[model samples]
Target: MRIFLIVALLLSVSFVAGCSRRADDRAPGGRVIVSYWEKWTGFELDAMQRVADDFNRSQDRIEVRILPVSQIDVKLMLATAGGNPPDLAGLWTFSVPDFAEKGALTPIDAALQRAGIGRERFIPVFWDLCSHRGFQWAIPVAPAALALHYNRALFREAGLDPDRPPRSLAELESMNEKLTLVELTRTGRVVRLPYAQLTPAEQRSHAFMIVRAGHLPQEPGWWLDLMGVWFGGSLFDGRRITADAPGNLAAFQWFRDITAKYGIENLRNYGATGGNFASPQNPFLSGRVAMELQGPWMHNFIGKYAPDLDWGVAPFPAADPAAGKDTTLVESDVLVIPRGARHPAEAFAFLAYLCQREPAEKLALGQRKFTALRETSPSFFAAHPNPHIREFVRLASSPNAHAAPRLCIWRECQEELRVAAGNALWGMATPEAALAQVQERVAWRWDRMQARWERVAEARRKEWLDRELP
Candidate 1:
């Protein structure tokens, strides 16, 4: 709250210091320059840049200028507050709720209706992420979906069939047990043993370190709080925080058990021995971690760091009997026109062109991601950089697929839940206790948010409802 207040003060100051409107800048030939601020650099930038270049070549009325901006949310906040925001901003789907609620974004429903675009065009989960507060706020460009990526060699080493992947939580745990390795390090006497065979005393001792972890929940730790979706619950359901929901309790308990068995010191030692995520020694690439939940971007890292590593992708195993099949988390880089933009139509024109089948497929192929479009060109898979692109595409269309909650306090909720899960996983508290605290804290935050909304509801709704897009 204090940080928010500080930023709010900064925003008011910037508003008073009013800056030039860069979005209104025109080209030499009087073409409308649609300012697009994105955080993509390297080939990711090139992929979108190519799409922008194509759009410019295909039209004469508008030119989409792609500018690389770091710390997009902070920069975008200041720019929007200063009334000089870019015409279009490339942001993650997770950011929509907060920005939309703050009136920092222009709802795209009017433009979507004007263009005759509707839900039938894209995958449901991706399309859902673009909507919040009963309004369409953005359009997806390149989408990423999470799945379990396992080392084929490790499966074979553990006598598990390389062609078959675990489909349920129990099977995943069983396989994980078979694949785990613990090393006894005492006076240069090195011996490896199955973790299950270790006595409680040996398990608790610092004399051993886990050299291989089949699947450490904290390996990347990107989706800890969202794990409840697999167990059949969510963090927030429109009006309430469900941090201590039954499914979440099960999710965090499962986490606690894993953390307890693995021994934090052992796991930390193993993690210390591995290189950074992007490096060749990345636990997964080096075979330290046999399986992990990751997006299609992992293919690029594998190609660059561990070209010879044998790997395959599959939907993450479900932790529950119901609502668990084909479970996946999807995310995307989305395009939106900010609230103060001067060229909404022109910016959207470029977005429409890019969202079309050929260009969308082209952009996804370039970025090594998949398009949110319902249909892809026949040759898209053939040209895609990742051979497993189809799996992610299939997962994105899963009925169980989910994205970040559509709530203004999701960022706060995410952080709180992450810490709560950590408190359980690090043995500081039981899952029940940690999540209960989260439930109480988040409920209070939710109430505060509701109070603020009640105060601003009339004015904000009027602004959004009366806004024009032409």
Candidate 2:
């Protein structure tokens, strides 16, 4: 009996060990875990997580862990500078150039080529924005463009058809004049400007939009490149900065006239009348203002905040009706592979998947954020249908959409332009003078940058010359 018991115990132990080994053999192995960071919080975060979840379940080789990091730009800068970046991160399109220039990113040309995805699959402007200094540092995931948002109630009150919106700036100005009212309070009469409440940042952004449309005067005022093109000023002889141009001067003059002579409201007083631009009680939403220049987010705002309000979305009015074709200014959120990444190749694989139009739409649909890709699934729009959402979706994917300048100096230039636009609106400086200062500053900075580039090029040329001569 004792011998039989010992044999039984040994057989049980051997059977258990064999089963454990078989289980281990069936387990999926060699997973490259990628740590990802993004700015999206709340709904945006949820959408991104859905994509990550899908990718994780699709295959076992790569496991993507999506980390939510608000204030993404500051976080990315600190992380990269500290030499400890995540495997993948979502960055703003503008910051791509800045990050790439500083060597904080790895180029994805080979990955893109390997995947058989080229520039043609994406919006040209957004693709160009990601390409800086001859390298592709990031991939655009979502794109937004500016458009005109008008209150239908205001249009009806002013004796106009809400469905038939303004096709020209002159018509819009006319509508604004009709909508303007002077409210007589007990103390005194207060001005109720129709198209008021735009911040200095918004105003300058609007000016940039207008300049792109070629309506603002041309020459070297404020941002001469914008004014230069509008005013027909030549900033460079195809090589160096040239500030002297009639186009620049005209742009400056136009800037001043639009703020002062026209019924354009002051940025300060306008803010008091309504909540912030994103709020439900925003000037445009609350009927305090008849029209506004806003992005695709407004679609969500209207659906969630003021569903009953009638509104129309159209492109920013062109300077020359014939010349300007419904152009949208494209901005985007990008996914990047940071330097020192633990799993860069895996990170890039996820990024490439994110850029795929169908999966991107699924994510956008889940989050309620707008789509950036050219081809979105029909169900995405069907699920979140606002009045002008389809129009925005159409514009977002359109070929005419353009990206704002990606030059490193763009931040400073934007700040200066904002200040100048405010000064012009408040009558602190004539539009022409205010814009002139901006142009002057840009010229000085541009010249300095050009000189530095020239010297670097000259040194490279000399090195090559010497090598060849020897």
Best candidate (score: TM-score): 1
Question: What local lDDT does model 1 show for residue 422?
Answer: 92
Clash numbers, per candidate? 0, 14
Estimated TM-score for each candidate: 0.93, 0.76
Instruction: List candidate 1 segments past 4 Å from native.
Output: 1-24, 185-189, 196-207
lDDT of 1 by residue, 76-177 (tens): 999999888899999999998899999999887888888878889999888889888788899988999999999999999888998898889888888988
TM-score of 1: 0.93
Native-to-model Cα distance after best TM-score fit, residue 374 in candidate 1, in Å: 0.9
Q: Please report how far candidate 2 places residue 365 from its true position, in Å.
A: 1.9
lDDT of 2: 0.64
lDDT value, residue 298 of candidate 2: 74
Deviating ranges (above 4 Å) for candidate 2: 1-30, 184-255, 262-268, 397-400, 450-470
lDDT of 2 by residue, 4-64 (tens): 9999999999997775432221224767778888888887788888889999889888988
When summed lDDT is taken over every stretch of 10 residues in candidate 1, the lowest stretch is 16-25
What RMSD, rounded to one decimal, does every model reach? 6.3, 11.8
